[model samples]
Target: MATGLHAPILDWYAENARDLPWRRPDAGPWAILVSEIMLQQTPVVRVLPVWDEWMRRWPTPAALAAEPPGEAVRHWGRLGYPRRALNLHACARAITAEHGGRVPSSYESLRALPGVGDYTAAAVASFAFGGSHAVLDTNVRRVLARAVRGEEYPPKATTTAERKLAESLLPPLDAPRWAVAVMELGALVCTARAPRCADCPVAAACAWRLAGRPAYQGPERRGQTYAGTDRQCRGRLLAVLREAHGAVPKAALDVVWDDAVQRERALDGLVADGLAEALPDDAYRLPA
Candidate 1:
C-alpha cells in the first residue's frame, strides 16, 4: 500500500506542484528555512511578497544577524504573529555565531535553533537537506488521516499513532520529495473544508473516500477570532511602533484602539513578550 501510495502521489506532484521560489533548485537552505518559518499559520499567497523582500534584503543568516531585532519586527509587515520576527532574528544570530552562518542539515541541530520544533526540524532536514524524516505538518496529517486511516480528520494535536503512520509511509528513495508531495496533495486536493476527492491522485485507494466521505467526528473545530481581541489590539499598537522613526508617544498607540484598559494590557503584553520597549516618558518602540 505504501509503494502504491508513493508512485501516484509522486507522479501527480511532478506535474502539479506549485513553482514556488523556495522550491527552486537555486534556493538555499536559508531561503527554505525562512519560508518554513514565515509559513507557520500564514498562507502562501500572503507570504510571497514579504518573503521576496526579506530574501532580497537579507539573503543569508549573517545578513539578518547584522541588523537589530527591531529591524526584523519592522520588516515583519503584518505577517500577524510578530513574535516570529523576533524568534527568527534570534535564530539567525545563533546560526551565524554557532553554525558558521549556515542552516544546519541535521534535525537535531535545526531543532536546537530558536522557535524550531520537531515538525520544523524534520521539515528542514527533509526539504532542505534530503534527510529522510517524517514531516508531519497540518497538511500532511490531513492527507494521511483520510487516505490511510479512513478518518475525516486527525486529532487536534499530533499523536504517537500519527507519527508512526507518517514514518511508516516514508519512501526509501527521495523521501523528501515524497514528504512534500503528500503535503501538496493535502493542500491542493484533500483540503480541510472541502476536499476535492475527485481530483485526488489516490482517490481509488483512499480509505475515507471508500467509506463514503464521512464527516469529521472529532471535537468541534473552532475558527480563530481576531477582531476586538488582545491580538488585534497588539497588532494595532505594534503598527504605530513599526512606522515611527523613533519612540512613539503613548497617545499614538491610544488612538489606534479605543478601550483604554484593553489597549494598556496589549501594550504591556507586547513589552513583556519582548516585541516592544516601554520608554521612561510614556513612549513605546520596537525593541532596539
Candidate 2:
C-alpha cells in the first residue's frame, strides 16, 4: 500500500464498514470461518440471515460435527455451491477430532482441513485471529491491481507476483486491520462496476486514477448461463430432495425437468457430488 493511502483507507473504513454479524467483536473463529466460506461467491445480503441461523443452530465445530452431512447440505439452502456445506461439515468433524473442537489458528492447519485453500486459510487466520497474513481475496486483489499495478482488474488467476504484492502492502503493525481495510475499500469504493473514485480515500495515489481508468481488454468476460443448464437442473432436482422427508420416487424427479437425458444426468451428478443419494428402489433423496 502507498504510505499516504494507508491512513485515508483505514480512516474511511472506520466510519463506513458494514456492521455484518461476522465482524462483531463477539463473533468467534468458527463464526468468522463460516461467514468467509459462505461469502465466497454469494452476496452479503444473501449470506447474512443464513449465517445468523446457522451460527444459532451450530455454534461450535462439535455441534455441527454431531450431525449427518445430509443435515448440513439441507441447511445450506440456496448458497449456490452446496458442496461447500459438505466441506464445512467434514471440516467441523476434523476440527473436533484433531484440534479439540476449535478452529485451528495456524494457516497450515486451516489449509489442511477439507476444502480449505490458501485464500481461505489466509482469510481465516487474518480475520478470525487478527494475525498478520496476506489476505488476497478478490476484493483485495482488485484494489491492488487498480491502485498499485494500474490495471482495471487483477489477472484472472492469482500469481506469485500478486502474493508478493499483497505481502508487501501489509502495514508494519496492525497488519490484520490494514488487510481488512484495503479489502473493504475495494468492496465499497473501488468496485468492479461503478467505482466511487471521487470519494475514494486513495484516489490521488491510485495508479488507475493517475492513468485515466481504462476498460479491461484481456479477454472476453462471459457470464454464466443457468437456464436449461445442468446447474439449473441440479437445483431443481435438489429442491425436491431438500423439501422431502423420505425417498423421492424417480417419477417425482421426472417432473422437475423435461429433458430426460439432462434430468437423469443432473440427478446422477448430484449423487456423484454427494449432495444426494440413490436408494435401492431407484428412488432418490439427500444423502444420509
Candidate 3:
C-alpha cells in the first residue's frame, strides 16, 4: 500500500503543485523557516504577501534579530496570531546568538527554537534541510486518516497510533518530496470539509473510499468564533498599538472596543503575553 501510494501522489504533485516562492531552489533555509512559521493556521494566500514583504525586509535571521520585537509584531499586520511574530523574533535572536545566524538543520535543534512545536520543527527540517521525518500536520493527518485508517477525520489531538502510521508510510528515499506531495494532496484533494475523492490520486486505494466514505464519528469539531470575544478585543487593541509610532494614550485603545472592561482585560492580556507594553503615564504601545 505504501509503495502504491507514493508514485501517483508524487506524479500528481509534479503536475499540480503550486509555485510558492518558499519552494523555489533559491529560497534557502531561512526563507523556508520563515514560511513555515508564518503558515501556521494562516492560509497560503494570506501568507504569500506577508512572506514576500518579510523576505524583502529581513532576509536573514540576523537581520530580523537586530530589529525590536515590537517591529516584528507591527509588521505581523493582521495575521490574527500576533504572538507568532514575537516567537519568530525570539527565534531570530536565538538563531543569531547561538547558531551563528543560520536556520538549524536538525529537528532537535529547530524544535528548541521559540514557538516551534513538533509539527513545525519537523516541517522545517524536512522541507528546508531535506531531513527525513514524519511531518504530521493537519493536512497530512487528514490524508492519513482517510487513505490509510479508513476514518473520515483524525482525532482532535494527535495520538501514538497516528504518529506510528505516519512514520510507517514514510519512504526510505526521497522522503522529503514524498512528505510535501502527500501534504499537497491533502490540501488540494482530501480536504476536511469536502474531499474531492475523484481528484485524489490515491482514491482508488483509499481505505475510506473503499469503505464508502464514512462520516466522521469522533468528537464534535467546533469552529472558533472571534466576534466580540476577548480575542477580538485584543486584536482591536493591538491594531491601535501596531499603527502607532509611539505610545498611544489609553483613550486611543478605549475607542476601538465599546466594552471598557473587556477592552481593559484584553489590554492586560496583551501585556501579559508580551505583545504590548504599558507606560506609567497610562499609555500603551507594542512591545519594544
Candidate 4:
C-alpha cells in the first residue's frame, strides 16, 4: 500500500515541489536545521527571509555557538516565543561542543542536543541525513489522517498510535523524500481550512475521499487570540529589549502597552523565563 502511494507522491514532488531554500541541493544540514526550527510556529513565507538572514550571519553551528544567548534572542526579531531563540542558542552550543560543530545524524544523539525534542530530532535525522525515521509533523499528521485513516483532521496531538500508523506508511527507501512529499501534500493540498482536494495527487487513493469526505467530528480547537493578550504583551516587551544594545529603561517598555498590570506581568514573566534580566535601576534587557 505504501509503495503505491509512494510513487505518485515522489513523482509529483519531483515536478511540483516548492523551490524551498532548505531543499536546494547545495544547502547544508545546518541550513536545513535552522529552517526546521524557524518553521516551528511561522509560515513558510515569513520564514524565508529570516532563514536567509540567519544563514548569512551564522552559517555554521560554531559561529552561533560563539554568540551570546541574548544575541540570538535579539536576532530572532519579532518571532514569537523567544524561548525558542534561547533553545536554538543552546542547541548550537551543544552541536559545536559535542558534535564537533556538526549536526548529528543519529536521532538519539540529535535528541540529546539542547532544545531538540522528538519531532525536531526526527525531522533533522530524516531530512538532512536521509535516515528512516517517522517524521510526523503537523502537516504530515493531517495528510496521513485524511489519506489513510479517513479522518478530516489529525488528533489533538501526536500520540503513540499516530506514530505507529504513520510509520506503517513510510516507504522502505528514500524515506526522506516520502516524508517531505507527504508534508508538502498537506501544506499545499490537504490544508486545515481550505484543502485543494481537486489538485491533490493522492485524491483518488485517499480514504477520506472514498468515504465521501466526512468532516472531522472532534471538539473544535479555537484559533489563538493574540490581540491584547499575554502573547502580544510578551512580543512588545521582547521587541523593546531586542532593539536596545543594553538595558532598556522600564519606562520605555511601559509605553508599548497601556495596561500597567499586564505590562509588568509580561516583563516579570520574561525575567522569570531567563529571556530578560532586571537591572538594579529597574531596567530590563535580554539576558547577558
Candidate 5:
C-alpha cells in the first residue's frame, strides 16, 4: 500500500509524462545531462529549440570540449545566466579528459566534475546511469512538500531532511522512473503559482489540499531583481564580447554601460569567473 507519495506519483507519471525530447528512450546520457543543465530556471519552451541546436552542433562531450569556450558562449544566446554556459563548457572538458568523453555512471564520479552540483549529479546518476537515487529538483521538492509533508511550499534550498524524506519514499525497484515521475508531476500539474489540484493524481491523499489548500500565508518568496543590477551589466559586457570573433577593445565594451564602477566590476567578475580573458592589450574575449 505505498503509504507515502512515490508509488502513486510514479504510476501517474507513466500515464501522463510529457513527451520531452530528453526523456526519449534513445536519448544519450550526454544529451540528458545537457537538458538538465539548460532546464535550470529556464522554461521548457525556451529550452526545446536551443537544446536541439546544441545537440546538433556538439553531439558528445568530447565535441564540446574540443571547441573553444568562446563557441559555447556564443551559442548560449539570451540564456540570461551566461556563467552556466562557462561551467557547462568546463564540465564537458572535464568529462572528456577524465571520463574518456563519456558521462560518468557513478554519483561520486559525476559529482566530482566541474559544475555538476548536487541536483545535476543526482539527475545524471538517476536518468543516465539508472541509479535509484532521488533527483530532487525544485519541482520535485514542491510536489513532495504539498502532497506528502502538507507544506504549502518547499524550502529555499534542498535540505538533508528533504533528501531523506524523498529517498525514503523512493521505491527500491525502478527508482529512477519514480524520481522522474514526481518531477513530471510538478512540471505539468503541481505548478509553482497555481497547481491544478483538481487534476492532481494524488489529490485525494494530498495533505495540504485536505487542509483546505490555504494560500501561502507566510511572507511571499521574494523574486530576484534583475533590472539595472550588476547581472544586467554583465549581460551587456558579455554580449559585446560574444559578438566579436576575436579580442574586443576595452573602449568598445565601455559603451555598453555608463557607470564606470559598475561596468568595471562586472568585467572583473567575468574575468575572475574565467568566462572572459583580458588580452595582452587590455582587450577582452571569451577564454580560449
Candidate 6:
C-alpha cells in the first residue's frame, strides 16, 4: 500500500519544486542523465552553470563523445570529483557507439554505462522516463527514516530494509513524481538539521515528529573534513590543470600545496585515476 504521506508530499512538490533547467518538460533523457551525474556529491547551486554550459556545448551523447576526454575534464571546472567527468565522457562514448547516440532507457543499459551506478540509473529511469523506481538518495532515506520509521536519522549506508521500505512506500500510479517528491521533501522540508517542520506537509504523519523527535542514539555521524587531507591536495592540483588550457609545468602544480611529498602523491594518484596524464615533458595535463 502507498504510504499515507505520499499525497501531501507529492502535492507539496508540485507547488514548491525548484525551477531547475533539467526539470523542465523539454529536458531530454541525456540531459537528465547528465544532471544526475553532476549532482552526485555536488550541490545544485554549483552544478547549474556547468550543466548549462555542457548542454550548450554538447547537447547530445554523440556531440560529447566526439570531443576528447580531456575537454570534458577541462569543462568540469571546480565542481570537484574530476573522475566523474571522465566517467561521463566514457558514458557518452558508449552511448554514441553502442546505443546509437541516445541515452538508454532500461535500468540495465543505464547501469551498464560508465559511472552510472544503481542509484543514478534508477534516478534517470524514474525522472526522465517515469519509471516506477524507488529512488533512495540520502535525503529520501532521511525523510523515510523520520516520517515512517520514527528514527532521528538513517544509517550511514543504505540497507536492504530501507530499500524494501522505499519500494513499499512507492505509489504505483504516480511513481516518478512520487520518487522525486519524496526526494524533494527530504531536500526541502525534512532536512538533516533544522528541518522546517511547520512547512512540511506530512509533519502530522511523521513518526519522528510523533515520537517527540528523539535525539539519535545509534551512532555518531561525522561530517567530512577537507582541510589538510590528500583530497585537498588533489583538488589543489586539479585546479591548476583545470585552469590551464594546455599541459602545465611541474612548477605550476608545486605552488598550490606547501608539502611537496603530499602534492606529488596526489598528482600521481590523479594520473593513475585517469583524471590527469603525465606528459613526456615531465608536466601534467588532464587526460585526452
Using all chains and alpha carbons, the TM-scores for the candidates as numbered come to 0.98, 0.97, 0.98, 0.96, 0.94, 0.97
**1-288 per-residue lDDT for model 6 (tens digits):** 436887798789989999899889999999999999999988899999999999999999999999989899999998988889999999999999898888999888998998998799999988898888888898889998998889989999999999999999877697988888888888888888999999999888888999999999888889789899999999988888888988899999988899988988998899999988899878988887
How far residue 40's Cα lies from its native spot in candidate 3, in Å, is 0.6
Quickly count the clashes in candidate 1.
0
Ranking by lDDT: 1, 3, 6, 2, 4, 5
Q: Could you give candidate 1's per-residue lDDT for residues 55-138 as a string of tens digits? A: 999999999999999999999999979899998999999999999999999999999998899988998998899999999999
Estimate, for each residue in 128-188, the C-alpha lDDT of model 2 and write its tens digit.
9888899998899999899988989998889999999888778888888888898888888
TM-score preference between candidates 2 and 4, better one: 2
The local distance difference test score of each candidate is: 0.92, 0.90, 0.92, 0.87, 0.86, 0.90
The digit string of per-residue lDDT tens for model 5 on 1-288 reads 335566677778878988999989889899988988888889899989888999999999999998988788889888768777877898899988888889889988888876678889989899988897878899989987888778889887778988888877778688888888888889999998889998887999998999988777655788889989999999999999888989999999999999999999999999998779999888999889
Q: Any idea what lDDT model 5 has? A: 0.86
lDDT of 6 at 54: 100
Query: In model 2, how large is the Cα lDDT of residue 239?
Result: 85
Predicted candidate 3 versus true structure: per-residue lDDT over 1-288, tens digit per residue: 467899899999999999999999998998998899899999999999999999999999999999999999999998879999999999999999999999989999999999999999999999888899999999999999998899999999999999998898889898899999989998889998999998888899999999999888988999889799999899888998999978999988888999998888889999999999989889988888
Runs off by more than 4 Å, candidate 2: none
Give residue 168's error in model 5 in angstroms.
0.8
Error of 4 at 265 (Å): 1.6
lDDT value for model 6: 0.90
Regions of model 6 farther than 4 Å from truth? none
